[model samples]
Target: MCELLGMSANVPTDICFSFTGLIQRGGNTGPHKDGWGITFYEGKGFRTFKDPQPSCDSKIAELVQNYPIKSRAVVSHIRQANRGQVNLENTHPFTRELWGRYWTFAHNGQLTDYQKLNTGHFRPVGETDSELSFCWLLQKLEQRFPEPPQDMEAMFAYVAECCDELRELGVYNMLLSDGEYVMTYCTNHLYWITRKAPFGKATLLDEDVTINFQEETTPNDVVSVVATQPLTGNETWHRMKPGEYNLFHFGERVGGNVDELADVAFAEAKPKSQAPTEPL
Candidate 1:
């Protein structure tokens, strides 16, 4: 298994605070220590960094923590090596060019009998089942739509359909983006939080660090973070149900199988801090 972290913002935003907690899980606070990688989508340009070493000890991870590269859509992953060797090629988040955009993908779960899917034009550069799934997903999309669809919602529905098929094989939680919108699918566990006006302080669950976002963000800024678990101890996070698919663009949720739940919508919801009880 693995863990995923993603960000979608109305304006360019840095994910240092959330990433700090996530990296700790890669080796320090959690067991997913095989490798880690992250991708940042800034306008039409993007940057990616990956390492086969444990994120808790990797100098590359340290540099990522200190660097404040801002972007609208970002995807990250920390792997536990369930289906691939511990190497850079096996690390996520994987990237490919599609529709003249840099599309990134990261998976947090494994699939059984995943080799049955056709790879089409996109081929896996790594031996991981995660990469196989990613290539297959893109192949399916390419076969269905030779060009980016004019109606984005229709495309989202198609992606959800593809995800549903994957879920039939095994756990299929994933995050995908193409500089425009971030699409997330949950087969078992995933959570998200959005920050807007009247920002507040948040303390990291994996470190003794705190940040007052009110001072760091303007009133008009809107930022959203999605992770396998809640990254902050003090913020209210929305838990995605099994079989849920959500899409966020420009920091605001625009499409999904479920209605977009605002930050306040989950204000009174109880925390799902207990280990996941749902079957994978």
Candidate 2:
């Protein structure tokens, strides 16, 4: 299995702290160490990095830790190989051009009997089920809608349905984005947290470093972080229920139901949470 990390925010924010901790999990703290990657959205395009080495030791990961590449949306992954070989092409957050924009995705689950899906316009450069799934997802989206929909809720629902179908094959926990927003679905474990006006100090589970977010953020900042598991000890990370999906925009969950809102409050305390193989 692999691990996933994602972010959606109202303003450009750095992922340094969380990412540094996550990198440790890629080799030092946990088993997901075959490869690692991260993506930062800058308007319609992205700045991405990937390597076929444990994040804890990868030179690229070190650069990521030192670089302050901030973005409104980001996605990252660290892998523990199962279906794919340990190679550059097999790494993730996979990307493809769809609907005239770059779409990125990362997954952390295995898919049994998943070879039946079709990937018309979208194709995989990597030989991984996760990559295949991304291509298939994009293909379906194009078949259903020739252009981006103005009704985002409807669009989200459609995305959920497509994700659900993928789940029928096997575990399909994933994070998806097209620069504007992020769509997260759970097949096993995932968690999320949003930092706002009352930002506070938080420490990483894998590293000794602690960040006092209030000192680095503005009063108007609204940044949300999603991961396979809770990174900090204090925040209440909400777990998305099985067979559930969430849409985030401007650092907050949209289309909130009461139960879902409660879940968000609890997201940081929950189970868990990638972006592509290609270096950029």
Candidate 3:
């Protein structure tokens, strides 16, 4: 299985803080050392960085850690090599163009009989079950709507249905985005945290680093992060139930099969004490 990380924000926000923790899992703090990749969406265009090497030892990962590339949406993955070789071609966070917009996808968990899925126009460049699943999903969407649909809620519902089908094959926790909306589905382990007004400090669980978001963000800034596990030790991350789907736009949860009462409980939980802040 692989580990996934994603972010969506109302304003352009850098994911250096979260990325710092995720990279540690790629080799240092965890066992997902096969490979890693990340995609950042800037407007309708996006850029991706992939390395077949473990993220903890990759120079590119270090550069990304230091550089603050602000974006509206981001997706990243660290692979453990379940169904594919450890190579650049099999890295996660795959990208393809759809409806004149770029779509980015990253997935965790392995599936059985994924090869049976027919991919129409979109084809996988690698042998990973992750890439093949991504291609098949895009093909289905294109078949359903040749052009972009005006009814986004309907489109999101269709996406959730497609994900449900994939989940039937195996665990299918995923993060997908088309530069505007970030969609997530969890079959097993997945958690999310949203920060808005009255921002507080957060401490990374995998690293001895802390950031005071209130000093770095404005009162109106809304930022949300999703991961296979909780990235911050002190922050309360909402754990998505099995077979749950969520859609996030501008850092707010707008759609999906969510429990409203659970969301309210998470919102009411008090944050832990703050730690000393460090520059990113």
Candidate 4:
């Protein structure tokens, strides 16, 4: 299995605080030490940092922790290597170009018969089931809509349906983004928390670090974080149901497969938290 971390913010924000806790799990506080990678979306383009070494010890990981690369949407993963060999190409947070946009994907679980899934034109560069699944998904989307769909909510719903089919094979927790919106699907474990005005202090669960977000954010900032597990013990993270799917844009939960009531509840929820402040 692997661990996933993602962010969608109204303003460009850095994920240093949450990332610091996640990296510690790569070899220190947790056992997902095979490799790790992170992608930060800046405008229409994005950049990624990957390493086959344990994130807790990798210098590259250290740089990402210290450097605040601000992004509107972010996807990151720490792997435990159940399917593929430990290497850079096999790292999580795989990327592909679709509809002239760079789409990033990361998976936290495994599948049994993923190789049977036809990828069509898109193909996997790595041996992991996660990569294969990602390619297959893109192929399907391309087949259905040669160009990007105008109805993004419908497109995201289709993605959730695809994820459901994949879950039939095995566990399929995932985070996917295309610089604008982040889509998440869960078959096992996934949690999320949104923060806005009147920010509060948060302490990391894996490390001895505390941050008072109020001192670092404006009154209008809205930021949402999604992860395989709660990164902070002090915050109240909403746990996604086993078969739930969610969609987020500009730090707000816009749509998903959940009932209308649940969607409304999330949309009208009070503002809650901050990521990091620094130039990209």
Model 3 Cα lDDT, one tens digit per residue, 25-127? 9999899999999999999999898899999999999989999999989999999998988988899889998888889999999899999999987989989
**Residue pairs clashing, model 3:** none
Per-residue lDDT for 103 in model 2?
83
lDDT of each: 0.86, 0.82, 0.88, 0.88
Clashes of 2: 24
Give the candidates in order of lDDT, highest first: 4, 3, 1, 2
Task: Score candidate 2 by lDDT.
Answer: 0.82
lDDT of 4 by residue, 42-154 (tens): 99899999999999999999999999999989999999999989998999899999889899999999899888999998989889999999999999999998998999889
What is the C-alpha lDDT profile of model 1 across 145-262, one tens digit per residue? Answer: 9997788778878988999999999999999999889989999879888788878777777877778788799999999888998887667778888789889988988888876653
Candidate 1 lDDT (Cα, 0 to 1): 0.86
Which digits, one per residue and each the tens of the lDDT, describe model 2 over residues 109-164? 99987788898866778689999998888888888888876787677778888888
Model 1: per-residue Cα lDDT at residue 93: 94
lDDT, candidate 3, residue 123? 86
TM-score of candidate 2 against the unseen true structure: 0.92
Off by more than 4 A, model 3: 260-280
Best by lDDT: 4
> Of models 1 and 3, which has the larger lDDT?
3
